[model samples]
Target chain A: MLSAHDVTRSFGGLTAVNHVSLEIGAREIVGLVGPNGSGKTTLLNLLSGFLAPTSGEIRFDGTAVSARRAWQPSRLGLRRTFQLPKLPARMSVLEVMLAGGRLPAGASPWRSLLTPGAVRREEAAFLDKAMGLLAEVDLAGLADHPAGGLSGGQQKLLGLAAALMDDPAVLLLDEPTAGVNPSLRRRMADHLRRIREGGTALVIVEHDMGFIGDLCDRCLALDKGAVIANCRPDELSGNQQVVEAYLGRRRPGVPLRVVAGGTAGAKSSGARA
Target chain B: MLEFCLHVLIMSAIFGIAAVSLNLQAGTSGLLNFGQIALFGIGAYAVAILTRAGLPWPAALLAGMAAAALGGFAIGRLGRDLAAEYWALATLAVAELVRLVALNEDWLTGGPQGIGGITGLFPGLDGPARALATLALAAALLLATALTARRLGETQFGRVLRLMRENPDLATALGHDIVACKVKVLAIGGAMAGLAGGLYTLYLAFIGPDQLLPFETFLIWTMVVLGGLGNVAGAVVGALLVTTLYAGIPFLKDIVALPSDLTGSLRVFAIGSIVLAALMLKPQGLVPERLRRLHAQRP
Candidate 1:
């Protein structure tokens, strides 16, 4: 559903994302994992049209979208979320989601003012869709509340819900679970899985290995702006380079402790407290 | 005394319209438009020119609104590419350019001589009929503007504008076309200023380039700041208070021993002091935007 060819981006003398190319078919959930200063977010930005690739062509659903403006890409079925949830402080959660829904094809000044009944009906439909999306994200109760009042995890959920409002064919999520508690992170991962099952492609950038392993169909690892490993989640755990990159070196003398009774459920309940 | 108070009230109504428009562009849209007076001047000139060419009052008034909207559209286009401070400077330049054009375009505007002998709102009416007509028109404009402000404030468009003000990056990420939204706001605000200008010309039956001066721009800005940024009702109250002070303070010369010239300077000084005090004590004005209300409501 989304493809990039020879995508490379540079800032001044620094190459942020160099010669990176990837593709994800429909209904596939792909996780992009890297250490700090890795080009995961930059690659996502380039794909989403927030940052123009210095030398690359991005094709979304077979149409080239590399040259399109950031604000126009969502209409072409490309949507993304920032690492930090960027909700407008003044807008209610429902209002923010409504903004995410594409503007009607015939929305012009004359139509807006002269056809009040039509506008009202369109608005009601958009509101209903947004409300349904909010319910899916478990944020229906906060629909009327200003989005800024939400906690960090709730704001992330709101952001994801907003992306879903457009029924995007491909979603580029940057660090969706960075600051969220494990339980909410799991819920977010589950939401991604459900979205993928519904035929939408997702490319998620995350640092949490457990969440990515559980949710992603395939994991792509990057180091120094280049892909180091592209493997299945289970294989990624056993890859020698991946293990060394993440943990320096595995020691035979020290046994790895597998903590018990520390599921995402416990974390979420603690967060509620 | 009653006649003077009524005149002051009428002038205040006109100012209220201008202030509300200014608040829409500056407060709600987060644009620093320093050329609101230019729109007013465009409105006044449009009305005067069209009326002189034999058009009816209503048509002339709407023509004036259209003229101001065109000027606003031009400024909005410029505002799209420019940042706030640059946009403010560009608007000021545009206002001055309009005034210069009005001054030099003697064949159309009659130069410094100004336009006069224009008909009143109700041409055949005398006394109460004229007063009632003017009051009714002003009240209607105020009511319409208030409704527009309220509706726009509650809209998805308004939320996007506010988002632009708070975080341009997030606004873009959320799919708001910032430049288009800003232009729309500027055009709407310019239209409001034009309406005020048409009303003012009808009341005074005169138009002059001096009316579009920087002082006039500052006065509207002061009204917006004093009333509260982004609060349409506050603009009304602020305009009424400022106009009352502008007209009422001159009456104090009748009771005081001060000379007219000294009292004029003293009034100017007083206004400056009040603005400074307002900036220091209540920079947000008496009625801040509803977003601030949300902040206060939070735990």
Candidate 2:
């Protein structure tokens, strides 16, 4: 479980996220949606400890993690993916997955040198585990391929596989379906559902309304760095402010809620199509 | 001819030890350190000073290694927030700063004249016998360090370092303390370089500030590049090749009746051209690094 209190992050004169607070419960999937420059990614960055908040406190299962290094929160079982997946040019896909596994002993230089037998055994087990995860993401065949050479969609899938390698308690994904094909996007949705059933929580920042509407249990809509709507995904269309933010100013004669509802349906349908 | 061959072999093994260590840092981890000689210098000076203060050979050698490790750790710490290029420049500056200290501190470092008359590891043996013993010692040390470096490279620690080199942010996301990893690598590399320095001093019975020049660091880099950057065995071979070339180039003066001064610069020119050819023709070096297979034999 994770919670933030009045978190704000700014860069120079730009206030990207202002007085935003959020909580993510165990096994829950929360969708973060907003138009461009709405601070969705910034909020995710702040929550995942990739970037420190300009002001506010964040706690993960009761431990303050704001002052900790990005890696520290990760050790506490919180993991995140970038908007554009980070894959090194020289690293094999399997190597990337192996790096993601939780094996502190094998990571120690001393243990690696002095007790190589133990390290080898640990590595063999992890190699199997990583291979299995890669298979789940339909990347088992490309395990030996240089990760940087993979297609964008494949890279995103690899990113997911790598993050899952940590067996993280909470996973934050930024636009996982951004460049993915429709079939792969559907597969990812199924994967996330299984992950939630397995007791891990998720926070997804996405512009794909249909994906968010179908997958998210709850949704938060933002405008200009402030939360404008907090409701079930189905109820997002009924929120007047969210509609105005997405579809622009309402016509004077018609009830804005109905217009908002109609447009949300059209948008989600178009997105799915 | 036998003595000349042994001299070349001994020098190659000594420099090979340092080259292998540098490979672990720059080749394996992508640290791109440009101050490698400084760590080597620290080791040499630690031995020189500690021996002068009446410390035994083995103890003085270890103390030199520890001192060099500390210097390496300091460089790693300073580069924590720097990008790769800036960090490289910082390493260069630190190396120059170190050379300056050795240059200016006359009483401690014997000024430009350097310290001499240090005892050799095998003082009782004379002539070729002593050279043979020193060659054997250097070869053994090189073998040990190379094996250790190779073992470390095959482990998950090596995978983590590759990740750090390739994508520091991603490595961090995977819960690796990258700064700590950098420091650890530098320390290990520094210690190995230190060992090589101590052996060099013991082999020659002297050391000077001139040996710590920035050009020495570039020579190590060329060794790493000429061998596959990430291949441990390649580093050793590269060192041998380069050292042999350096030693043999002066012989051309005899055949061609060249000017005396030209031989010194000729070696540098020959090395520079070989590096360029290597880069353009076989950028992966003589022994290109292979990707670690998941089903590869366990180390």
Candidate 3:
């Protein structure tokens, strides 16, 4: 389980994440939903140890990880994926997956040189495992292709596969479905369910309300770096604060009909006009 | 002519070793190390200074390697939070600092005049035979370094390095201490460069502050780029081609009757042109690194 308590991060005078406290239980799929600049991604970064919070604590499996290095959380089985996949140029897709796997004993330069035969064997085994993961993500055909050459959707899939390589206990995925196709998105929703069933917790940041409502058990809606609503995913559309925050609060004299038009000008001018 | 040929071969081998070392750092690890010659210089100076202090040749050589490695580790540590471009600038500054120290320290480094008349490894052999013996040693070390570099690229350590190079954030998020990885890469590369420097001093029986110039680092970069940035074989080929071109320039001067000072300028121009042409025409160099098709392999 992972928990963030009163975590606030400020850049200059502007607070990006303000007094955010949340808990992720084992195998739970928590959807983080917010408008642009709502601090969803910043929250993910803070939770994943990519950015140290300005104040408060983030504990993973009861270990305080707020001051730890970004790699330290992942070493404790807290993994994450970027909104834009971070695949390097000239590196093959399969190699990316292998890098995500359990750090091999042969990863030590001394062991690699001293017992090359064992290193080779370990690499061969990892290679096989990587291929299987690639197949699962339908990226097996592109395994040898340069990762940099992958399309946005494919790169997202590769990011997921790579994160899964180490069998992480918790995965913080930022916009996994943003560039993905509808069919692939549906398949991914199913795959994520299967992953959760396999005991891996997931915190997904997504813009697609339908995807979140359909796939997530619970959803947290954020507005201006503060949590506006915390409710079951299906109840999100009906939550007044969530709707007001996402759709914008209606003017005092404006008819609900005019507000439904959802334009700045239309909302400012009442339906009576 | 034989002596000239031997000199070219020996110099090519020595520079070849340094080039391969640079490729490992710049190519594989994605470190933009403009201080490479400083690492090389540290070894050369360590050998020259420690040997003059009456240390045994083997001990002095090892000391030189250790010093270079330590210097490299320091560079890695200092550049930990810097972006690649800034880190590169920092390395350049570090190298210039080292050169200034060598130039200013007269008693220890023999000043800009440098230490000379040092004993060579094969001093017992007659002139041609001695040159041949040195060539043999240089060539053997070059081969060993190239093979070691190749083997290193195939290992798990190499995979992590490549990952760190490409995406440090992702590599770190995947449970790798990229700082530690960077330090290890630099130390390893520094040791290799140090070895090349030691061999260089041993062969020429001399070393000076002039040898630690930033231009010397760029020369090795040219070799790495010409040979195909990440490929060990390419670095060697590039080193051989460039060193031979440099050595052959004196003969060109004799044939063309060029001014003596102009010839030195000409060498710089020639090297600059080759690097420019290589970047524009064949950016991958003569021998590009082979990408591993791990999916094609069976368990």
- Top candidate by TM-score: 3
TM-score of 2: 0.94
Colliding residue pairs in candidate 3:
B227-B234
lDDT for each residue of candidate 3 in A1-273, tens digit (9 for 90 to 100): 999999899999989899999999899999999777889999999999999999999999998885457788888899999999958878899888888887566678778788877887777777778888888889999998999889888898898888888888999999999988999999889888888988899999999988898888899888778888888999888888776666667778956563344565443342223
The residue pairs in collision within model 2 are none
lDDT of 3: 0.88
DockQ of each: 0.20, 0.65, 0.74
Docking verdict class for candidate 2: medium
Residue range B205-256, candidate 3, lDDT tens digits: 8999999999999999999999998888999999999999988886787799
lDDT of 1 by residue, B141-174 (tens): 8778777765676556666677787666666666
**Which 10 residues in a row give candidate 1 chain A its minimum summed lDDT?**
A264-273
Report the Cα lDDT for candidate 2: 0.87
RMSD of each: 6.5, 3.8, 2.3
**lDDT of residue B250 for candidate 1:** 78
Q: State the lDDT of candidate 1 residue by residue for A117-185, as single tens digits.
A: 766677777777887888899988887788888999999999888888778888889999989997887
Per-model TM-score of chain A alone?
Answer: 0.87, 0.90, 0.93
